[model samples]
Target: MEDQFFELMCEKSSSESANTSGRTEEFLDSSANTVDISENEEERDKMTNFLQVIESYTDQEFRRNFRLNSSTARMLIDRYNTSSFYTNKEHGGLPKVGASKEIYILLSYMANTNTFREIANLFNMSKSSAWRILRRVVEWLLSIGHEYIQWPSASKVQDNMRKFKAMKNIPNFVGCIDCSHINIKAPVSNKHAYFKRKQFYSPQLQVVVDADKMFIDVFAGEPGSLHDSRILRRSSIYEKATDDVESKFPFNSFLLGDTAYGNSQGLISAFRENGFLTPA
Candidate 1:
């Protein structure tokens, strides 16, 4: 543009050059002004190109990705704008931080780490908005997950254990007890406290699963601070003295656990009570 302006100025001033020095001053001013104009025009062209790229997104593709049906999208957004936490009995209307409806829908598919950004891109929502919705849905799920997911009783556990007898050297089992871990972010302070003896940063989960590996009953959620031994001692399953209770189980059935569990009354594991689990 500067070059073009200079060329035009030169062409216009060529005839004037024969007149006087005043013409040179005027021409220089005109050339300088022309350069600014050309620069502004170039900038405008660049802006136009940028805007074109932004606008190039196909409406069809966008609508599909964003789940952007006008009525549904507006309703969901409005619900988020007005609605509060589903778990909060006290606080009525809208989740405290992340309860946007669009995000909640995304979480229904979040069996894995599939990201909020991907969801946002698909849903045509802001990443932050998608993230908030996901969070709230998770909280909501957690809040009610327990009531729906229940702990089975002793007889149920006993009945399932009989099938394991089919496996050689396995018998009289009610359930298998073990520890699982829940993933979490490291806290800023006392990092070691959350860390398990396994040297991992996860919450320890104590579960009692039947022979088929279906969860019979569980100790539920607990921090990693305690050891497997202490966790069992404190668990309601342990306190119930399930093994000692006289039940109608054939041979007064029992359960199994790792060597981590020492001998307890009626609770049978090869680690603690050998012959109870040994094959017929």
Candidate 2:
């Protein structure tokens, strides 16, 4: 009887050891699975947060924040994805951020005066990433700008002229030309050259717009101190007008300008009052 009791105790001890071993293995497997699941959830949450921030804004809010409509923003993203610069295999780095998100970053930077650090925090990216996106998007946009902004075709010019006539009874008026100042930081060199009458440093942006208020031509980068007429004379439109006025101003079309620009061929300026003018 004593021998049988000892044998039974040994069997119980062995069974307990096996059961402990099995439990240890199961615990390790469960811990490893939990870790993997936790990591996946963390990553997924980051992406979801980014998307939620963007989608939470209404259409009007999106435009107000980004300075572009959602549809236009989507179109830009579609174009960016198909561009060769975005698709080149030679460039290597960590996996790229999505074009849609990068575009939002770029537009945010452009639409606001926020620094890279601020923009990065807003978009959940590094400052370096925000700067890189801005530079790349700007370069791509510059490459394609001419395709979208150009001198109107003859038919389009005629349509613009009719629209202008109907709107303000201005005969053969195709566009209105004006110059506005774009504020800029004072340059290290020639700081005074950019100083404008508004008590700030800036560069000039001269533009011509049709009756629909769409830009047909743009000239920029002149010093703010220069007069509007001087800037116009330095523009390509002036050069073209000087060479062959008929080619650009076909059908006797002309641009309307302010008193500052004065009267010239292919352009008409408003009369400046000197206290000696009749109503007619």
Candidate 3:
């Protein structure tokens, strides 16, 4: 499981180039001169349908949260051009799912502990399809979103003082990495060999994220049985550092990890030995 998780992490691209124009302020003002009203309305309805599929969130609830209405939804959907619903076919990319995106629908329902069967019933998809879509969306977010996260520069560090909670002389920390687990169904009878104890428990990454909930360095992807330290040892980020001749924070830079990570010159753990606490 540790090896597989590491493999997935390695699948993460190192590319940083992302089209910011499609997502930010420029989107806000794209509505005014955008002539075609029907096209815009179709896009809006897709988003609204998308929103409706996310269980437990009603139209009233969405309006309350976003401070917008049915009318505003049109502008928003137009601005949020990621959906293919209203795109002119001559433009590019695959077509929209016609109904709300199955991916969106699955994620919306995933916020809680809805069974695969229940989710499938609600979305009119097979349980396997629902699960597959959930995994793909997660991969997309981890791939694109993780790369686009720029570290807070020294110039912005002062402005971000609020994200920090000073400890000793150290300021806001990026993270104190940890791992957690979720319940999962056991494998089928003949596939028992493929199931590990951790396979019955899905891992969740926990990082003491900064203001943006972005990881400074410490991150999680270990199996339930693997120590956080061992996870770090096998991580591609660590591999890149240890193997790179020009890496900035070589093995000399300090990091904080779980008690399982222990203490090293370059890695700090809040350790307590024989009832005596060790100072950082």
TM-score of each: 0.50, 0.78, 0.53
Comparing 1 with 2 on lDDT, the higher-scoring candidate is: 2
Model 1 residue 233 CA deviation in Å: 1.8
- Every candidate's CA RMSD: 26.9, 25.8, 12.7
For residue 176, give model 2's deviation from the true position in Å: 0.4
Best by the lDDT measure? 2
Off by over 4 Å in 2: 1-48, 87-95
- TM-score-best of 2 and 3: 2
* Clashing residue pairs in candidate 1 (N, C-alpha, C atoms within 3 angstroms): 65-122, 66-123, 66-124, 83-93, 83-94, 84-93, 84-94, 84-95, 174-254
Model 1 bad stretches (over 4 Å):
1-110, 115-119, 139-148, 151-155, 188-190, 197-199, 242-244, 247-251, 272-280
Candidate 3 residue-wise lDDT at 122:
60
The residue-level lDDT of candidate 2 at 259 comes to 93
Q: After superposition, how far is residue 61 of candidate 2 from its true place, in Å?
A: 1.8
Per-model C-alpha lDDT, please? Answer: 0.46, 0.67, 0.40
> Which residue pairs show backbone clashes in model 3?
none
Cα miss at 141, model 1 (Å)? 3.5
Candidate 3 regions exceeding 4 Å error are 1-100, 125-132, 148-174, 187-200, 203-208, 216-222, 240-253, 278-280
Q: Over the full model, what C-alpha lDDT does candidate 3 score relative to the true structure? A: 0.40
lDDT leaderboard ranking = 2, 1, 3
Q: What tens digits encode model 2's per-residue C-alpha lDDT throughout 215-248?
A: 6676666678999999999877787777878888
